[model samples]
Target: MTERETTYEAPQGEGRDRQPAGQASPAERSVGDSVFHRHERAVDEVPDQPAVIAPGEKYQLSSAGRRWRIGEIFKLLRKYEVWNDITPVRLRCLLEELGPIFVKMGQILANRSEILPQRFCDELRKLRTDVDPVPYTIVRDCLHAEYRRPLSEVFSWIDEEPLGSASLAQVHRARLVTGEDVAVKVQRPGAQQVMAQDIDIMRSIVRLASHFVQTDQFVDLHDVVEELWESFREETNFIMEARNLDDFYEFHLGTKGISCPRPYMKLCTEHVVVMDYVDGVSISDPDALIDAGYSLKQLGSRIVEDYSTQVLDDGFFHADPHAGNIIVKDGVVYFIDLGMVGRMSNHDRLIVKDIIYSVAEGDVPKLKDSLLRFAVSRGDSGALDHAAFLSDLDYIVADFAGLDLKDLDIGEFLTSLVNLARKNDVELPSVVTMFARGMVTLEGLLSEYMPHVNMIQIIRSHIANEKSTYKRLEDGARELSVESLRAARGTLEAAEHIGLATRMLTRGQLKVNTQIMGSEEVLRHVGGIVDRMSMSIVIAGLFIGSSVVYYAKIEPVIFGIPVIGFLGYASALILALGLGREIWRNGHARK
Candidate 1:
């Protein structure tokens, strides 16, 4: 059998009682006790079931349950008087009381200072995900169920006290049987089930609220829910986290001054992850680093430099780089918690490069183009007001013109640019937003370490150093060649069209079609004028005929007037009065 198959399967001829091949042992059975597993089993039992279900269906909550949860949420909102006045502290408190999903949402929003006020972002940043630790016995039982072999075969020792506990999982330091120290991250039992239910509830609330509220004016409720769901999915799947660690480890191979934990793939599963244990000072505690004889400025500079490399060169970066996720050991910075990361394609990276370069050079048009290229348009492109967008961009660029790198705030600048894009009906990708938030978090860390260190300057320097002059020249030449070919093709197409038109003209078969803009409205006005003129002519005829008839009176008369003439006169007066009122109303409307 293959190595992967062996890793998950029970060993053959073991001394312990063995089930038939492909049958799960008691330990394996116990591992499937979570609701997520039960749901999977239930689905598997069904015949001809599709591979996937809608999010609402997959994360099902009964009608009554959903209503009750929504009621609780509304009550909390009312209690805080969120509609009338929502302070930063009150918002934070509401999120905390709402539960983990809401707290996660607040944490994400905390990074979006461009959308929220800085004070609100600051208050949200203060949100702590530390929850009460799961009992040690439960942790042990979970680990035992995950391992096919006995616990003693894998870990020599595991600390009863958790190293740290968070909303999703808790970490504990353990020593492997191979005498290497490792950190084991165990998922809380039924954590995924609870998170899934909460997400479903959130979706329901957003959907219900959307009917009576125009929330899209401020934020995309559906997008926020999806983003939260995506984050939750990644953060809960320890297997994906293990893979991320492996990839990041490979990325940092032979690199210096920066590292990530090396995951033990054999020991990792959906519910558990075992990786190299980092025993280092958390970057959050600057005092300890200073006591450890580390230069804070150098550390901060290194972080910014390494992060730039991760983003621009590697394209994969740690999405959440809060101080807690970073540690310093012997001057080496270790980025941990690979649950969340961001990625940019080569095309996106180039556009980002152009955006940064254009901003630095104060090229407003170029900046606008790069931003538009990076943004995803929600409406008709033709409907976009490019001139107005450019004007706004010009204002933003002017604010940053001639500013020294050290004085520039990268996070604030990115936020402004994103906000401008949003205001102009353009949306940047979620990864870009994620990167912006990561930068803001990084900047916050730098403030504590060394306030003067400029992240943008570091990024600029890194970009310059990343490519040689010859390489850049080659890239420029390639781009020029591509553009030249496009231009030549366009010229040829124009010539062909002209030749056809000339031949048609020589043959006396040429025709031209013209259309005036706003012709529909013009035609409607013309029709109205004609109707009014026709009515006036009829009115004049009626008055003239009635006068003639009255003067010629040769038939029965009523009070010295012919009956037909009298009726005509009455009709003409009524018509004239009606026409006059319409004319007067139209004249007043114009005014």
Candidate 2:
């Protein structure tokens, strides 16, 4: 066999095992504990970070929150007369009153400009990231602890006045001793403690809301909070942020024309990042670029292309692509805030590319499967109504045409999509929402400058190129065969699982009366798999036999039909019919 063919078979032997080959017994430590340990280590390494007082805080919260029972909450709402505002204003006000966790929630909701109703999102977007900047003394002390040196020794001059202050960190302009102008980002003192408390509050909110509210038509609050926690945790790690900066800079390969602030390796710490700062006019001021002798259309088009390439091409993106994050400096777009980024594995990237391609081609079935793959986490056992998903997809895809892609309200589509999934109890990946958010933001940015640009055409071209590249890599027959074998192995494992179900049923492991319907569904699914596999085997057998016969110069007829041609066709059809009949009967009988 050729090297490619030999390499293809390398994974074939191991593919049958769902776990790694020669699986070991489960370790005493769980993955959750390992993750927690890492978090603890990171926290311990940060100097002068305040200890979290969970018990005291919990007591205070329980005592305070008890006053706002269901009746009281409703009474307050009525007294404020805020029930008439469907504009998300009332919700914003509530979040403000609830404290930092709710503020963080508002930020996350704002990021989902696509998945949220525009009016609601528009209102929530107004929730500023501004918080009380940590006292200058606290900031100085934290910096001193991080560097273990006098602040003046490194920086010739440091601005006490912050350029901007957000909930987590604040930025200040400074000059290094070597005369390099830079920006220093200092984490707020006791920030980690604040985050822990805020997270606890968020968890409590989700728990309470899930128990009391009618949000079955949207994402379950608990799961959304879990996703939010992961996002926030990832963002809070400065090491991760440093890596994000480096990774995107390397991935972009300089053609992106966007600049990342270079991290000063020696000066960086868990709570502080010193980096070269680029001065620019904010993207929010559309007129500023024009006055600076730059074409708005050119700038907007570049933003769209850069974002498309990052997502569809590189599979890593700045999850937050809002205008405030983009700065026009020396005619180049500078991407700031490296904390939040999204990364997709190659497999995920290919699947997403297929999804985008299917959407562009108006392939309803393919689009539905792609969306399911995009939404449903691996090993999810929940019932997904593929037919219903396809129906909704048909409406969206059909409507996507005719309108200028830039003008198409993706925000509206995502709201509908999220609603549909929520209604069916389908859990979508938070990263997918992040993707949608980034794309929507890019489109919104483009609209500010190049209003007439056809975004659909732009996205279509990007997807086409991505698909072409994928096809090129997958064109090798050996690679194709390997993928086929891997798929077969997966099918076989599923079959074994079905056999286990049968064994469990025989052993009375299942609750007979309560599980009758579920059992029937499982049987139908297994039977369908069996039928398809049988048909495939038979068809392959006939084709191979017929090919051998033709090669051997066999007789022209077989049972009064032309040998190898008509007989093979007839045999294949019979096999398909048998399988189809078996599948149909199994479904009917099970029901």
Candidate 3:
């Protein structure tokens, strides 16, 4: 019990590597000391600790519900003759017992069908976020406070009954005084508090779960939950949603094909967002849409073309494109709920294009290299799995080869690739997952309508266009070489100046009259002088090399013919001689 209690202390925030500028408090100092001692103790005698929970909470079934014990989670399968198949059914049952947050988490997990088994995602895909609507009084009060107006002045007709209620917010059909039809997305009062509490619990559970479940280590589950929390928090703020809607409107301005619901600025508030209601059949109901005189194939193509343009061309996209969030009215696709959108930096956008082009051309090594470089630079360490990652890519390319262009499950493949990367400990860049989820949902919606549309061929054409753009980018990079050279020269000069200044400043030595100091102290001081001399030599060589590389752009062998190359070699030798002299003088004086 004592040992368990001791192990339960929270992990220190990764020591000096992660510490911010602020001075450490006494408590923090103690924690750092303890961490160092504990690490040393482990080296002497490794203790058996509970399993690791990678990125999320450390959930014990007991915390949520005593009906199931941690032991029972595994034991029930054995006792109930269900041990042979722990498939999606067992998972769904567990999530149901765990409650709403877990259900929503499961649904998010479901979207990553590639990383998770199809059976599991299929089962969790059924998990919905519909909760009982809060009382109309609570909703009205929230609306009043958020908008700072009486409910009467805001809408000509506001329905008390919610169109849909979820964990975060509820949607109600309403009309503005201007007579524009709209959906009033109202936040439930205190949802932020509820979500924060739930997330705290989830985080705790994820921390502990990682210890017991090896899979938890594959994904940064804690980071995933934290990101989800931030996403949902933004969803609660109607102002951000309004901004997202506006961003989308501007994003699709030149194009006639893509459209997002127009937010009524006057009617929108922190708690309530009023947008032109999309009065169309849901994307999920393809047959109904087809019957409504819409060409399913055309609709599918439009979805692909529009979304591809948003992600690839504009670099901003709706992260969630579930059928519920998209509607088709008169063949025009209307996007609703712009709470979660993905934004890619120009660099990442280029990397994504590279990935797309590589995937289209079936360039394995290029794809692998691009993915690894991107992952290493853009993602955290725990988020990448190098070997399994490559294997998954291989399988994805090989598995989906012979399908008709339109019938190809591009979304599934991408999602699976992301999930594979995630599961193998590669933390996917947020934009990549956003693209993956958006593409998957778009593809899924499209496939329902256009059974024969060749998505692969379409994407291939898009990739060709992207390649042209990439060439332009390459030319721009070449243009930047001049700027890069100037920057490199400035940096080298600054380093040289700093080195000279430090040397001048430290030329005078402090003589401590400590009679008790022995031969070991002398040796330590001599060793420190040697180390500094060695570092000076390395820095001097680097400075000379930088000058040669930046200005001359020439590789220098000792036997190089040119003046600058020979100068670089001579400069390096002089620095080495100076360092050797310093070492000799310092070492002799110490002796």
Q: Write the per-residue lDDT of candidate 3 for residues 397-488, one digit (tens) a residue.
A: 66665455655677777776676665555556767876776776666555565666666666667756655777978977987998899999
Q: Give the lowest summed-lDDT range of ten residues in model 3.
A: 3-12
TM-score of each: 0.76, 0.64, 0.61
The local distance difference test score of each candidate is: 0.79, 0.65, 0.66
CA RMSD per model (angstroms): 8.9, 23.7, 23.2
Error of 2 at 265 (Å): 3.0
Separate clash counts for every candidate: 0, 0, 33
Q: On TM-score, who's better, 1 or 3?
A: 1
The segments of candidate 2 whose C-alpha lies over 4 angstroms from its true place after superposition are: 1-87, 93-100, 110-118, 212-219, 378-381, 401-407, 410-415, 466-591
Candidate No. with top TM-score: 1
Compose the digit string of candidate 2's lDDT tens values, residues 1-591.
453232112223333112321211111012223323444554567645633435554213333334333344466457556767544877777666444456767766765543467678778866657655544444555665565545557776666557887766888788887889889988755444445545666577667766666564234556657766787677666777877777777776567467677777677766678888888988788788789987777777677677777877788899877787889888778788888888876766777776656655778787767767776552246665566666777887787644565566654555555555555556667667777666666666666656766665666676666556657676656678998999999999999989988999999996545434326767978886886887799888887876667566566765654576667767877887877787799789979
Ranking by TM-score: 1, 2, 3
